[model samples]
Target: MAGACVAALLASSACSSSQDASPMSDSSASNASQKLSGTVTVFAAASLKESFTTLGADFEKAHPGTKVTFSFGGSDSLAASITGGAPTDVFAAASPRTMAVVSDAGGVSGTPTTFVRNQLEIATRPGNPDAIGSLEDLTDPKLKVVLCDRTVPCGAAAQKALDGSKLKLTPVSYEQDVKGALTKVVLKEADAAVVYKTDVRAAGDKVGGVEFPESADAVNDYPIALLKDAPNAAAAKAFIDYVQSAAGQKVLTSAGFLKP
Candidate 1:
């Protein structure tokens, strides 16, 4: 009887040890990995609205306990904000030049990676009432053209394109961001606006997009970096990694943004 009891006890101990050694279920593992909670503030260029917003949602879904908040505006303005002490976790600029502003100030932690590229386009009211066809059309004195402020990436790119075409033109208004420039056209406040192609696409039928060859001269390369003082550094790095992933590439390309 004693021998039989000892053998049974050994078998029970083995079963307990096996149970302890078993791997956690996939759901439990996911829950454990998703313990990253709290808000991740992202400052991205205005042009990245669609794709970045989609990625933010995906990131949230991937990390159930975490939340992503965004501040989208002109890249230069956003970079300034970061440098000026506006609390931010990630900074995604439309131009490396603008990002250099933050990098120069040591506002970010690591090297910024170029994630996407964009080109300028003329955004006009539906039907292009200005009869705008090329970059020189913007030189028409009678046209009330709006452009992104020269400080903004879109505006800087527009200047490059204009310089490349050797066309001297001036805009009636220099808005803070591409969206502001597009809004002027959408609201008929201006005849046209020099904005990013993505902005024109986002505006849909509200505006007509005119692609000029000179835009190639000012194709902007977007770069993203994690802020040095990121409140959520771990989640910030994870978000940046996700943005460079294949899934994120699909979302960005679907929005007409070029792969990096």
Candidate 2:
């Protein structure tokens, strides 16, 4: 009886040890001991709204007692805000040129890393009633087309594509951001608008997307950096790490963003 009891006790101890070493258990232990807290403020491009919002939630969940705040707008505007003294923890821009705006001002803590790439696409009314097939279609004088301002990344990409194709387009209006440009088509205020493909996907059935080969020549590389005056530097770094992690890539790729 005593021998049998000793063998059973040893088996139970091995089972307990196995459970403690499990991946789930290790993850729980790591999270419980994680020192991250406070809020991480991110200034990002408008095109990143959907994916970044989802990432923010995931970050908060992964680190309890933490919060994430975002200010989404044109990368150029966000860069201006950063250089002009916005107290943000991180900056994710749609283009390297826009990121250079802040980096040149000595506002970045470290070298900015490219996280993704985006391409321009024509966003038309749902079902593409106008049957706009390519960039040339947007040049029709009768069509009310909108574009992002020449200063923004999407606008710059669109302009590059147009220039490459030797196409001249006179838009009815130029919006401040990609979302704003897409909204024109979604609201039927414009027959079409040149914006990022990711924005078109985020709009769901609200808009239709038309791809142009010239867009290939105008793809933009997105970069992210930690601010020199970050209010929550530690959390900011963690958030950046998370964004570049496999899990983050999955979320971004699933949202139609291209891997860097």
Candidate 3:
């Protein structure tokens, strides 16, 4: 009878141990899965500078001990760098065509997802000093106009809009990025520039924005993806998720970006 009682106690102890060793609770497992750390490096288009910077700051706050670094420039240039083996965690391009440049080169980890879309706008000097109101007005030889280089996404979109409207514009100079084109108007170096609507909004009182019907024809979709050899894949993916989350969308939409 004593031996029988000893076996019963041992079985009870074994059952208790089994219960204690059961799989972690769902919440515990989720928390363990979400733990992320390290710096996430992003190569992004110049147009994303303001919005992405805001999102990056919010991401860092949400994930303690993680950092987000950005290299903002023309999407084409950024894609070239990535394809050339530049070490980065993520790439956010201003347009699908530019994103394709990386994907075709096998520099991206997965399919690039479109996150937002942007439309072209005429950025003019403050208070309409040039009185420029339409795409045709830019054709006047008297205005000192600046345009993005045709190779850049913004420039390409502008060309599309012009072509759709059957309009031809000659600019005093061509800039390599949207920011460069907008800066010409902001500094009053150029009377007007064709840039992204978001860029005009970001400039605040520094420049005035003119919307033309043709802009609808030249809307550019922005895409984001993880690079093939990301050094910080976990953090990079977390940042990308945050960018697509409701909180991130709120910040981006509030900044004048259109939802994809």
Give me the candidate number with maximum lDDT: 2
Model 1, 97-166: lDDT tens per residue?
Answer: 9999999999889899999999888998899876899989989999999988889889889988888878
What is candidate 2's lDDT per residue for 37-130, written digit by digit as tens?
9999999999999999999999999998899999999999999989999899999999999999999999999899999998888999999999
Candidate 3's error at 3, in angstroms? Answer: 14
lDDT values for all models: 0.90, 0.94, 0.92
10 residues in a row with least lDDT, candidate 1: 18-27
Question: Which of the numbered candidates is closest to the native, going by highest TM-score?
Answer: 3
TM for every model, in the order presented, reads 0.91, 0.88, 0.91
Return the lDDT, model 3, position 231. 99
* lDDT of predicted model 3: 0.92
**Residue lDDT tens for model 3, 110-182:** 8999999998889998899778889999999999999999999999999998898899988999999999999
Better of 1 and 2 by TM-score: 1
Deviation in angstroms for 193 in model 1?
Answer: 0.9
Instruction: Give stretches of model 1 more than 4 Å off.
Output: 1-16, 19-22, 25-34
